[model samples]
Every structure is written in structure tokens, then in C-alpha cells.
Target: SGGPNYKVALGRRDGLSYATEEAVLSFLPSPTSNVTALIDVFTELDLTTKDLVTLSGAHTIGIAHCSSFENRLFPTQDSTLDPIFAENLYLTCPVINISSTTVIDIRTPNTFDNKYYVDLLHREGLFTSDQGLYEDFRTKPFVIIFALCQHLFFENFVYSMTKMGQLSVLTGSQGEIRRNCSALNSNLSWYAVDGDGHDGKVF
Candidate 1:
């Protein structure tokens, strides 16, 4: 499939750093976070507001475990959530700690499309972080632009994904590879994208 491209640089080392619970919480944004908080997390990774909204389109085909959005149902539902949408989610999630899941996109849960942004425009966003895009003036335009045209969303998503994949990456034996390098590789499929230099290149 010919599209906006990013190069693949192989043999990069993976980081093994692990921090304490407090430190971990300091960086991870909550599902209920607002635009400001969500943008803060993206900025930490050099992602832009446009990238945040465009990448959010992935939710079109996404699913979330009950634990992920259960809080919205319990402890009084979130005011921003559409009442009809929340009611349906309650039926799916039912009681606290019940094991279940729900789709992010109400219109089409299995397509890579713009319906996620469309849902946000109707205040039907599943997560606070998602709805924050429409509620905040700074990011609302990107949501409208993507919702109106999926091709635009796809183009921006490719660039954003390529950018994210290159963050602090270590190439050319700069770090250690703890696992087997290639002994068991014959069991897996392999592919390589031959390409010229690009800012999106990742290992």
C-alpha cells in the first residue's frame, strides 16, 4: 500500500527502565483527563495537539475493558457524557467490578474512520480525555477537520505515528538487547521497508 512513509531501522535496543508507583502515576494521563492534561502528556513525547486529535481517530475501531471506563458509570456519571450513551454503557458494564467491555465508536466500532470525532462533536465521547478535544477551543478545529474528512485524519495519523516511533530510540548497537537476538527468529514472519532517509525512521 503506497502512502505517507517512514523508514524502519532495525536492531534498536529497548529500554528496561521501571519506576515506582508514584513516579509511574506522574507520567500516565488518566482516561478522564481534560485537554490540558492530555496535551501535557503528548508534549512530554514531542507530540502536538493535532497529533493528539488525529491519533485519537484510532478509537474508531477500539474497545475498552469495563475497568477502563467503569468510573464514569459509578460514583455518579460524568456530566459531559451523553445520557443515552451513558445508559447503554451502564447496561453493558452493569455493576461495579463486573467483567465486561464496550466499543469506543458508537456508529462503527470496526472501521478505521472519522466517526470517533463525529461522536465527540455530539458529546458522545466515551472518555473525558476524548471529549476534551471538542470542548477545548484550542483543539476543536482539528476534531472538526478530521471528522469531516478521514483522508486528512489518515495522513496526519501516519506522520504522528512515525514521529512517536522515533522518540529517544537507540540505533546501531547503542544499548543492550537482553533477549535472544535471532536464534528463534525463523518461527516469525519478517519484513523490511527499503527506503531513503526520513525523520520518521524507527528501529
Candidate 2:
């Protein structure tokens, strides 16, 4: 992976509890979102338009399930998609092929560089939300800049990511510093629950 390494801001505390599925979904922008919708979502999160374009570079190295973008393929192929790219996607994901997956960045699929912006420039961006950034005037300039220079993308990505990490931060006594991230502090029990709904000592 040609991914850049940056020092992450540490000392961030975790929330005392997890967010509900509805809450999580509410906070996340949908893949089918247009540029305006994406910008609005990020703006609500206190991120700038530049940050929106920069952070989306993360798409440079991931796979997306067909269901996430099949709408763009079916009902009618998205006109903005490159003809060759759309044909390839049709082969990878036909109707009712929900389990099929495709790489986000067709060019340099495994690399974490600026190829995602390159893909956008060529109209090969896999998601509407992604390609829209290139067509939207507000974000198109940054897209062009990053596509022309990988160094700037990496630098801005780092800054935007750090800034994003600071949002809604939990301070002293607001959240916990979990000893183990997977299990909640309250779930670290020495006993198990019996079928009768009683706590039974594991010993």
C-alpha cells in the first residue's frame, strides 16, 4: 500500500455507549447522495467542502457491495459513468446480484494515493456521491487540485481527518477509556447469564 502515515491525535475518549443503528444511519450520508447532499452532511458535521473532497480520497482502497450502487447501474445506467466502466460493472454485478462487490478505485485498486480523484476525472467514480464532487463547482476545483497533486491530497486529508476527530469530543467523565474496545466495560463479567435469566458464576 502506498498509503501515507501520519501521527493521529491521541487521548480521544470513547462514548459511554454505542449509538443506535438509526442514529448511526442518520449521521452517515448515503452512497447515492448528490454533491449538494454530501456537502450538507459534511457541513453539518463541521467539515468544509475541501475536507469533503479530501476525506473522500479514502475511497482509493475499498470494495463496495453491489447493492450500494446497483441503482446507478439498473433502472438505467448513469449517463455520467464512463461507458467502458459501466459495462464492466454490469458484468461484475447483474440484476439480483446483491452479494457481488467491486473496487471503489478501478485504477490502482490497492493503492491509497490520488487515483480516486483520477477516476472521478475520467467519470469512473463508482458512487454518485463520489463522481458528483467532480462535477459540482464547489468541490471540483479541489478535485482538480488533488488529481494533479497527490502530495496536497495527503496533506489535506491528514488535516481534515484530524479536524474531524475533534467533533463532539467527550471530555473528562463524559465517556470511558475502554480497556478493551470490542467489549463494553459493563460486559466484562466473570459470570454468564443462565437460560432462566439468572447470573451464574463461571467458576
Candidate 3:
């Protein structure tokens, strides 16, 4: 759980408008994306290859739904996925649409660390986008460096995350600051849950 501490500049203004689902999907890399696609998406945001791999370390702390990686398991296994890890994934997700989840980082899932890079080295990365880091020449070096030296990973992560925070940022008087960060100041009901109460969909 312990990780690097970096100073983040304060008083960053919140956006008045929320991103549309289509806009978000268009900009972000997909779970099954290759390193090239990842690089392209990040580059469009003015992020470098180093930023791509560094920011990817955030995967060390989240859980991914089985649906995100089922393609690599069903039909044919991804050659990059470790056999033992693949078997365990099969146990959790025997078939597609099973509605299960697993930690993104097989090792140190709760920690913000370079273990995600280590996972890539072992071919245990949960997503194609992740494993593809090791498969690509551009990103593989950063992966190896992060795997071997966690301090460098932490240092780079802080820089990349800070750089990312500056992108598309709204400046003074450009946007309103809502009392509740989740919703607009005028509309408290930012999202609606279906009858099943499973997920909140943004309007």
C-alpha cells in the first residue's frame, strides 16, 4: 500500500461538462488494444511512450471484469498469457459473460507499485494492452526498467500522472466547482440506476 509521495499542485478546476461515453471510448485505450493502439491514443493526448507505460502502472490497484479479458481465454489462449495464470482465469471465468472479476495485478494488487511491470515480465498481465507492453519494443524497455527498479517506476509514475492531470484542464472561471465531486452543482441526479440496480448510467 505504501508508494511514492509527490506534490500535486492544488486548486485544479473541475470541468463543467462531463465526457460523453463515446468521447471517453474514443480517447482511451481498450482492454484488448495492442501496444501500437495504446501508443497512438496516448500520443493523441500529448503523452509520451514513457507516460503510457508509467500511467499503466495504475492497473496495479484495480479489478477488471472478466469480460475485459475473455477474448484471450476463449476460442484460443493468448500465447503471452502464462499457462498457470490462464488456468486460474478459466476457473474464475469458465465462459464469456459469467460476470466475474479479478484483480488486475496478480501480485500486490492493492499496492501502487511496479509489480504490474513485473507481472508483464512473467506474462501474467491481465489485459492484452498490458501484456502487449512487453511484446512491443517501444514500451518493453520501460517495462523491464520498472520491473527491476521500483523506485524508477514510482518516480516516473508520479511525473506521468502529474503531466496527465494537466491535460484538457479547465482554468479559472472556466468551470464550476460542484459541492459534490460526482455530480454537477445544479443536477444532483447525475446518474440513473436500472431496475436491477446494477450500474449507474450517466445521462
Candidate 4:
């Protein structure tokens, strides 16, 4: 694979910073978001539903905070959950109003794997978004597909990441190149040119 080794072209200008409740709410896709909604978002950014599911498989690597799913543990829960899974969740999350920074995934907390889909089948999904995958018939088949083909999951992941990298890219004198990754001082502020720019910026 003769992939080009290239430096990102820099010099892009930063834009006005403003945030609204509605804007934040619109961008945060809930687990219950349907295929159509997902498709619309992707289309808006020149992507596809296939890319949506493929990229989402990246969830297998991280933990969701307890606040993300307190509803599942207190007051009411989906009756479909296995009692053992529910009990395990309680041990990890507890009943008290704990901080939102609790770990939910007990398996491979730092590695990518199909354990998320497996967890879903067992009713061990930590967030409503995670659990919603199985609850929605449209998404369940894809979840099962990911669970079955580990190699395919990895392959698709790579493809989606590559595609995502191209979306909204700022190149050719568009953004400032950072000299120090941590230090943020520049005559002209830089902006992220791709989708991954927003990563780790929010919970």
C-alpha cells in the first residue's frame, strides 16, 4: 500500500465560539436514535449509514459513566435484563448519587473487541444508548453481525476511520500547525478540520 506520507496543510482561521443548549442537544446522538436519524446526520456530513454502524463499533473500547445510565439501575429497568447482569451493574455503579465518572465495561476496558455486542445480548449494556441497540430491531441485526465477525469488524473500523478522516478536512493553508501539542499559543488559532476533532472534547 503506497499510502502517501504527508503533513497536514495548516493556516486555517478559527471561528466565533458560541454554544446553545439546543445545538449541544442536537449533536449528542442518543443510543435510541434510529437508523434514519443516523443516516440523516451522516448524509449531512457526506457519510453513510454503513459508516455510522462501523464507526460506532469503536465503543467497544471505553467505559460510559454511571450518570449516563442511572435510570436503568434506579426506579425502573427493562425487564429483559438478566438479573446477574443487573446485580453486577449495581456493584460497579451503586445506588448513591455517585459521580458520573464510573467505569461500566468490566471486560477489555482499554482494548477494542466485540464484548460490547455480547454484553448487549446479555442485557449488560451500561448506557441507554448501548441497551437501545438491542431493543431496536433495526440495529440488533447489525450488532449480532459485529459479534459474529471479529475480523470484519476490525476491517470495517479501519475503512470508516479512513473515510471519517476525509470529511470536512481543512488542508492547503487552512489551519495552523501546532508546534507543541499541549501548548496553545498562536497568532491565528487553529480549528479541527475533520470529525475526529471533537473526540475527547466531551463525555
Per-residue lDDT over 52-171 for candidate 1, one digit per residue giving the tens place of the 0 to 100 score:
888777788878888877777888988878899989998898888877888889998876678899999888888878888998998999999988987888788888887877788876
TM-score of each: 0.75, 0.88, 0.86, 0.68
- Candidate 3 lDDT, 1-203, residue by residue in tens: 87889998776677778989998788878999999888898889999999999999999899999999999998999999999999999999999898999999989989888899999999999999999999999999999999999999988889998999899887766876555777775576665546774445567
* Cα lDDT tens digits for candidate 2, 1-203: 99778887766778878889999999888999999899889989989999999999999999999988987898899999999999999998978557989899999999999999999999999998999999899999999999999999999998998898889988866776565676655576764557885545566
Local distance difference test, each candidate: 0.78, 0.89, 0.89, 0.64
The reply for model 1, stretches above 4 Å from the true place, is: 1-11, 15-28, 176-203
lDDT of the structure predicted as candidate 2: 0.89
lDDT for residue 106 in candidate 1, whole number 0-100: 90
Model 1: how far is 113 from its true place, Å?
1.1
The candidate 1 region of ten consecutive residues with least summed lDDT is 184-193
Superposed on all Cα atoms, the candidates' RMSDs to the truth, in angstroms, are 7.6, 5.3, 8.1, 8.7
| Tens-digit per-residue lDDT, 80-189, candidate 4 | 66788778777767874777554445565566777667777778776666666666776788778877887777777777777776666555655534444443333224
Please give the lDDT score for candidate 3. 0.89
As for candidate 3, its clashing pairs are none
Q: Candidate 2, which segments miss by more than 4 Å at Cα?
A: 188-203
Which model, 1 or 2, shows the larger TM-score? 2
Model 2 sits at a Cα RMSD from the real structure of 5.3
Cα shift from native, residue 182, model 3 (Å): 2.5
